[model samples]
Target: MIPATSSTPPLAELRGIGKTYGTGEHAVDALVGADLAIYPGEDMIIEGPSGSGKTTLISILGLLLRATTGSIRIGDREVGQLGERDLPALRAKTFGFVFQGFNLFPALTALENVALAIRMKDGKAKDPEGQARALLERVGLGPRAHHLPADMSGGQKQRVAIARALGGDPPILVGDEPTAALDTKTALSVMELLRGLASEHGRAVVVVTHDPRLERFADRVVRVEDGRIESNLPRLAQAS
Candidate 1:
């Protein structure tokens, strides 16, 4: 894994993180003793096989789920110290999410979809439609702005999803299996866009993926297995 160029403190930090589901003997540990630091403007990728707890780690980092044990620090504030009511607000302001399914509404045009997210993120957005158009343009989807997701290709749909996620300019952009559905070429294109989010926009980008081919775009790569992060991970190479 490559180290970040910045000498600044971590934007988000996790220590001794553990997670469990259910209770009693039925409990299953999804993650254990995971220590991670997300630096600003870094593109980090989390990789693991099926049931390796990679997704769980991303969830905890994105504040989508609570850790059963460990300290989660976002900036100077501890996650545990924040009230339940504050979580949604904090998550909205701190992270933008992209998922494998694209998550675009079939009924809405690409511009409408992005505009909706902008309004949802900041109800007082000065000009949501104009900002939405600019976002679509940024993702190279300006021509498809009026088209519904059903009329778009998989890559186009994902780009629209990315545009929507870019709303509010969240500091951290989290992606879960974002390229699992794309062909190799399209996947690389999307990964490049994600990497640009970190390098060009100064936002931290964290993605959970099973593809080693995507590692070249990452500044840091983490491997997890059996609920624990491997200490000495092999260097990423071209994988079949």
Candidate 2:
């Protein structure tokens, strides 16, 4: 089902999405008829309890998994029915992902981590070090560029992760529990950095986290429970 095109269409749209595991009495519905529209220049937060299917929802959004029903559109392209071979190109080109655990290579330094991402996004990246250092500097990690993940604090490691995610200049940034491992101050700092990036580039930022502290940073807060969205509302900042 195609949605009517708007002057500025959503970076990604999820309509009547459903995801189920198993079958018969043993079946578990992880998501049910979920509808969401993520736009550029907005930071959207999806929060809920541990079993509320937040991760499942993000998995589908990142193209790491498929919905059982309904359609998903990235910009104007409907990707729900796209074949496996077609998904990697679109996902690499459109989405950048950061995870709860810093998924950096243990052996690689921060600069190497970001450079690898640049190479993955564009096989022929010119001066990968130049691009990597610029991204690290953008994330306020220029001084830590040569540091290994083990040598940096959690926040710094996450910063490297974020910089790596930005390698392709993806239109959408997807974070699953991005700040979960950081302390309060660090988490807020990370959130501020993410918000600033999204605002500056008009890119969409989607985060699936259970931290209530994150609510204040979101333009829209969505609550998911029992495999369904309980509420989706704009925060005061966006409402004004």
> In order, how many clashes per candidate?
0, 0
Pairs clashing within candidate 2 = none
Give the TM-score comparing model 2 with the true structure, all chains together: 0.94
lDDT of 1 at 6: 48
Q: In model 1, what are the clashing residue pairs, if there are any?
A: none
Please provide, for model 2 over 1-240, each residue's C-alpha lDDT reduced to its tens digit, 9 standing for 90 to 100. Answer: 112244667888899999998899999999999998888788889999999899999899889898899799998889966788999999999999999899999999999999999998889889988999999999999999999999999999999999999997898899999999999999999998888888757788888889998888888888999999888777763466
TM-score of each: 0.93, 0.94
**In model 1, which runs have C-alpha deviations exceeding 4 angstroms?**
1-6, 231-240
> In model 1, what is the error at residue 99, expressed in angstroms?
0.6
lDDT string, candidate 1, 168-230, tens digits: 988889999999999999999999999987875568999999998998888777889999988
lDDT of 2 at 198: 80
lDDT of 2: 0.89
Which is the leading candidate under lDDT?
2
Question: All candidates: CA RMSD in angstroms?
Answer: 2.7, 3.2
lDDT of 1 at 49: 91
